[model samples]
Target chain A: MRIWHGLLIALGLGVAGGLYITAPAPLDAGFASDHTADTEAGALVFAAAGCASCHTAPDGASEGPQVLAGGHAFASDFGTFYAPNISPDPASGIGAWDLPTFARAVTKGVSPDGAHYYPAFPYASYQNMTDADVADLFAYMQTLPASAQPNQPHDVGFPFNIRRGLGLWKVAFMPDGYVTPAPDDPVLARGRYLAEGLAHCAECHTPRNAVGALLTDQWMAGAPNPSGKGRVPNITPAALDWSESDLIEYFTSGFTPDYDSAGGEMVEVIENLSQLPEADRAALAAYVAALPPIPSP
Target chain B: MKRIFGLSLATCALAAAAFAGSHANPALEGAVKARNAQMSVIAYHTGLLGGMAKGDVPYDAATAVAAAENLASAAAMKRAVLWIEGTEQGAVAGSRAKAEIWSDAAGFEEKAVALEAASSAMITAAGTDLDALRAAMADVGGSCGACHKAYRGPKN
Candidate 1:
């Protein structure tokens, strides 16, 4: 009995040691040391990235969306995850966060205190954001009106709630690189960057496994809406019959070839896209049109 | 014949009576089919004007004018039978129409009025210039969107 107790204790220690070793690893703090924060360019990046879509308060003060107090509720199969206040409030939001800390959180899903953010934050796709874009976004975010709204705790359950285990999940699933193949066309390249890295379009357009890791093999083939109310449509060439021009116009006006208007959550998405330059919309449409055909999932 | 049809109140009532004659769960289901067909007709003309506005379908003055005229007439349609109570989203399978259409009938009528005004403005201007058609398109689209936001749920 003494020998067995010793073995069990030893096994427990090994497991504990492994967990500690694999704790959500952030990129070196020095990675963000060089990019000069440009608030003007950052504003454009913010629009394309759609930070407000996930972070805005449901019924915030009259000051409006610029006050991103971050109480947006996102419901998923795992549980409900509320968007944290990202306003510039010194204590409630990330107001005190250094550029390095902000970069790691946005790009690596590792919080300043080293806890892993649930994948609902979409770091898998965000992990591809260029260093400069992330840095600029951080600077621009700091300019938003500060809100004292404290961050809400996510309602995820036991096994899923264990943040440390997410370190392993990241290792298994976090895309260390861009998933969309690089296109030679410069316009398409810009579109690819916006769609894959900043917009995180695949987060909804691509299906995921039981554990919620994106099924990268079925990129843009459409998936169930995280809210589970309706299915997201397939946009790959195999399913989308829209011509390149049709796509450009759709992005610009939210009008389908058949004249049906965009509905549901996509209305918000179109609002963001509409604020962007027509050239940017054109580029995004071009990239999406050129994507390799994949059958609907 | 004017390709631009504005299904007036009388015409819609007549169409409703015609559909009322059939019985696949009469009244309610017939109302659903009637409204659905009405929407289809509206969408068809919108598409022709939309295609011209987008430059995908080459713009011809006559075709654009006719499409815009059809849109004006369709937008003017007042089919009360199409929205009789109990035809909302949950009441029928594949119905994207929402309860707010009835709950907030005044607001719904305001949107219908907006659509009529927008499409009426388009008929003459659609054949004027590509830019004019585009401007009219924006108005028409806005009117359509305002109603859909309240009355149309996501695709069912």
Candidate 2:
């Protein structure tokens, strides 16, 4: 009877230990307090991040960027995940969320309720963002019109549906900072921030392991789109045989050198990119043009 | 008058036979080849104009105007017979046109009308100024996309 009692206590202790280990830690209070919100910079960050591409309703009838009512269904191997409403509606959106909660959600993939987020949110790439950018994005999002739309529940099944399991996946894949070292040049460094931090281009462009973690070693060599429709073309310097000017023009006009217009998911990305200043586009082109050429996979 | 009428009828019969034979096989194949060739020419002219717009090549007014004229003429050409019913997708190996084009005939015609309007506007704007050309570029690209999104397959 004593041995049975000891076993029960041990099992309870093990469960408690597991919960403690998986719990999400919010960002440092000092970081949130010190950061100031800038709406203008945030707007640029918002465009760079392509927030509307996923956050907007997938009905194909939603017009303009103002409505982020969020019912876009991202069907993946795990299951279909719907983007949650991030509009300023107090009851249905993130209006009640303080900057720290927003920051933690964007960067750490943690919810205000201390639950883990599915990586479909791309927080792994967003984790590289500076605290200032995240704050600015939060501020900018607040300026958009609010909607009263309720959040749609995701359709994940079985063990994959268990959100707690994602905490382990996060530990294995999420990096604490930039995936690669920042370049010495200020321009290239800013390009890295835009590309890796907010734009998260590598999320779509890089191939992934069987479990869907990005294969960082072959970064930006291109991969089959996660949505399983078509192959995303290789954009690494090795495979992209275009002049720097051609690259800039493609971003500005969506026309390839061969006269093929940008199609599929790229059309939306180019639309967002078109909103950016010419200088920002040029910076991106310069940075991509300078990447070490990787052979197409 | 009887001999003349008989000769005229014989000539009509021979012409109809030739037309039927062509429409049955080789002419249909010729149409697939001709339409593909015509599309290539359109792409070539557009590429030149696009190159100038991007400043990849020097924007010579003469070259720009010429390329724009070619594109406009190509877009306005009467090539309906080239896209006849039997030449889509599985009927021909290289044709990337989807079968929906036949079912959505009205939508396809609307897209063609849009391309014509855009191409006409492009001709008027092409050599006027860089700004005009840029504005026309968007319309031209948009019109192309409107059709391609619905009718064309992914490039291999």
Candidate 3:
């Protein structure tokens, strides 16, 4: 018995030593001469994501708050999840994360600590991003002034706190690889990337199951929010009220003839799209209007 | 207590009528400036009331009544401004303020009158019954939408 106990202790010590030695050190990837051009392009990608609206708290004002300061409340049928501070502060934010860890988190819904994050973070959409775009986003984040704001713990109840279960869930739901639009279909592909990944339209528009997973078979079908507002309408081709050009104009200017104008949550979407290059908006509209409608049951 | 509140509101309504009748001002430009400012406040109050109606926040019936009254009074005042020389040009920054407001002057007047009428109906509805309040609310939203469709910019 004494010999067995001694062996166990020796084995534990060896394992600990191996882990300590093999663990990566914090990232020190320096930005040298060539990275400058990439950084400028990265800035546009950052704007495309509209990262500022969620990160910044609206403290009783008309416009959204400062980028990366982190105080927006996202309300859903499940519960409200506050946005976290993503600024480059070493102690309170993503400053310590290495490039590989950031890429995994953004693309695979995994965190720096090797834990899976909730899809509420829109990793499903972001999973479609190209590696180079992901790299640029990281570079842009590095350029941001470090904010030392600590993250608030999520207000989820009971089993929701068991984040480890996300590992299994991710394996079932998340795609293993990033998507690339077909080379011959540039316009449609660009629209798909922007709508599925960056804009995250399905998060609000798609019907959800009891576990809060999206009902992919009914993607973009209209669904009601907890606030009891009008249901988010289907944008599929079967929505007979809208023409292709009408859809394009609505995205560009936020006016819908029957509904009057986009308000509440959609107002932010319009504001984001309004700032994009006109051609990008046109492409998005064209692709969306061309989608094969899930025929009425 | 309710009697005194009713009397005070009646007195204010009559005073608004007096103000509406006296069209004299610092001339066309000044009239337009004052009307635009007044209309902005009206629009802001509508937002506040709509927020309450949706229960996104808290509100009181008395406050709602007061807001509705002020908006009604402002809508009534627009006729004078519309008739004033170039007060027509002042509608632009208030966004969706159409140039056609001056050209189709009679149509614009009709919409403004409809809004004032809806506001008064809403105030009366709030004073008496919940059923009436619901009907009046629909009217108010419709009148705003109708006017916005015609004169306001598509960006609303």
The TM-score each candidate achieves on chain A is 0.92, 0.91, 0.79
- Specify the CAPRI tier of model 2: acceptable
Ranked by TM-score, the better of candidates 1 and 2 is 2
Considering only chain B, report the TM-score of each candidate against the true chain B: 0.80, 0.80, 0.64
Per-residue error (Å), model 3, residue A38 = 2.6
Q: Count the backbone clashes (under 3 Å) in each candidate.
A: 6, 0, 2
TM-scores of all candidate predictions against the true structure: 0.81, 0.82, 0.58
Looking at model 3, how many pairs of residues clash?
A: 2
Most accurate candidate by TM-score: 2
Query: What's model 1's TM-score?
Result: 0.81
lDDT of 1 by residue, B17-101 (tens): 5675643335567678878877788889988988887787888889989988888887777656467666677765557788888
Least lDDT summed over 10 consecutive residues: which range in candidate 1 chain A?
A: A58-67
Decoy 3 TM-score against native:
0.58
lDDT for each residue of candidate 2 in A29-72, tens digit (9 for 90 to 100): 66657777899999988988999889876763434556788999
Can you rank all candidates by lDDT, best first?
1, 2, 3
Candidate 1 scores an iRMS of 1.9
Q: Identify the leading candidate in terms of lDDT.
A: 1
User: What DockQ do the predictions score, one after another?
Assistant: 0.39, 0.33, 0.03
Of the candidates numbered 1 and 2, which has the greater DockQ value? 1
Tens-place lDDT per residue, model 3, A61-141, is: 334433485767776665677888888888877899877778777777777775667777878777777667778888888
| Number of the predicted model whose DockQ against the real structure is largest | 1
